[model samples]
Target: MRVALLILAVVVGSVIFNFTTPFHLGQIASNWGLIDVTIWITFVLCGLAFIILGILMAWWIYTYQYQPGQLAEYEPEDPVLEGRLTILTTIGVVVMLAPGLIAWNDYIAVPEDAIELEVFSEQWTWSFRLPGEDGIFGYAHNKNIDIIANPMGIRDDDPYAQDDLVIETNIVKVPVDKKIKVLLRSKDVLHDFWVPEIRAKMDSVPGMVTYFWFEPTRTGVFEILCAELCGSSHHAMRGEMHIVTREEYQLWLDDQITWAERKAGVVPLTPVQQLGQTVARDNGCFACHNTTGAAGTPGPTWKGMWGTEVELDDGSIVTRDEAYVRESITNPGAKLVKGFSNTMLQLSDDVTTEDIDALIEYLKTTTPAVE
Candidate 1:
């Protein structure tokens, strides 16, 4: 009878102990920083508790039996034992909490030398702005947008904005080991900017600004993804982040500023031309509309979309006259253009009529002469 009881106790203890231990260890290794340390401490404490419980169970099984004159020793209450247990439990809690509090404090303290950058999120893309050499960024309003001078709608009248660098893309780069603070805003829907490696994320809501900060400890490429499911292409709304040394970061910044300036100098003929360029660039149209005219783009060549006969969305064909082109530019849904999906959203509300005309003219002039 004793041998059978001992065997049962060993089997049950082994099963429970083996099952619980590995799960705790796996959780501890998955996360980083203070959380990971706290998890490890908790695992140790729980393991100790399980061992003590197991000992008590083994004693009960060895001493107690259903037969007459066979019963386990029972201590109803011992003040000293209770007091020692209380102290041990208190120590375990404190040990787990200390690192967590320290990490929380570190997370809240903004570094004095942190770099500030603003991130703007719209329906499906991210745009970034960094202060220029003066280390200041001025205020901007959507209403202040002068289509000719400032496509980003920055308020150039503000003296502090004289050299602010703006970029329209999802990619962001920062120097490793330097804290970076990002001001986030959404132009359309709500989105979350998340980077797992940095353990940082923040919500970008329309009509409001939110901010988050983090420092990359290692130099590597990381992914920036929209944590919230904003729309259809949410999964595809991803970008790359390059964490480089300070010198490499500086060189990259300089090149970005110079490229922005060069692009700014390429004046558009009209607001429509500007709108077309902006939409085309933002929607990755350039991948297919390159000057080299590679043939796999799956639609009528944007190289010469204007002044050409395009089949309509309603199964009717029409000459690409000014009116037809204007209609196509604004209400892309109205004309399917035969081969392409009408995935292009209605731009009529977003762009003015004059802008549409300008875009048409620009398209007419820039069409590649394919022989």
Candidate 2:
């Protein structure tokens, strides 16, 4: 009885600790309450088994304690007790598995009205694409991927791809209260797209598309994290998501560039600018600094930033002129941008003056000052 009371006390303490635990499942902003329910069911079933088995063990130990004059009788194979135990174990297993199966069924049953969004990932970076006005995505493949010309590798033969809105940066926006079917793709290796508040995550396998859906129930900015370890820089792979009203979402969408516009060279680049663009891509500069106007990129975007006043980590202001640009290439650690880490990859010593000049020309094109 004392042993049983101690077991009871332990169970009671566990229950209290669970309730008072500081660790929480941050925010449940999606239609996945069933996931939470399934977890609770699992916890209850496991706890009950632990208590029952623990008490039984205690009882048997106390009842069968060695007595000096008592000879123990080996009652091997009690069919009735064995049968009862088997039945109870089977019931418990089924109870634990049923909720998970049901939750998985609900997971894949995406609503027909759900809008499709594509998430494309590469080593330490993220990009997104959405369908055009026709609500259809163009065919894209890994073999056709290009760093600049065909970033997401949208096939040239697919007319649906022309109008597909491409967001080259890590940040993306979606409308609140709408179902979004996220299609995941990876250019190089495996990755996992995870947003904790939404309770939705899926693996992005190279050469194949994997997906999951969720309906945002609230409006807020959520952090996007790579839940899978892909490379040395995997921890640095992160993005931002803004869940906004339909009107705001639409406004943001309208400002995006389409594949056709990019292909057509809507924003033409000069010869020097083109050379600079190639230099930047070849040097892996775009891996951190964004070419697009997105604000949440790891490094400050070159777009609309030329000739603009910039603040440095030491609280000094400097103009993004030719001299500053040249110094940044030759000596990267000189001026660290505010709110950004000093993780900039240094240029090789052999990087020629001509290459720096070409890169500066390309950087100039990113700003509105060129046009």
Residues 1-371 of candidate 2: C-alpha lDDT, one tens digit per residue: 67756766786787778789988788788888888888778888897787677667777867877889999998988999999989988998898889889988888888999999999999998999999998899999988988888978899889898889988878888999999999999999999999988888889999899988999999998999999999999999999888989987886777677899988876545445555766887788988888677787778888887888899999999998889888887888898778988778888766788889989888887776444
Cα lDDT tens digits for candidate 1, 85-145 = 8998899889888887876666657677889988877667777888888888777766655
What residue pairs are clashing in model 2? none
| lDDT (0 to 1) per candidate | 0.67, 0.85
Evaluate model 1: give its lDDT. 0.67
lDDT, residue 243, candidate 1? 87
Residue 369 displacement (Å), model 2: 4.3
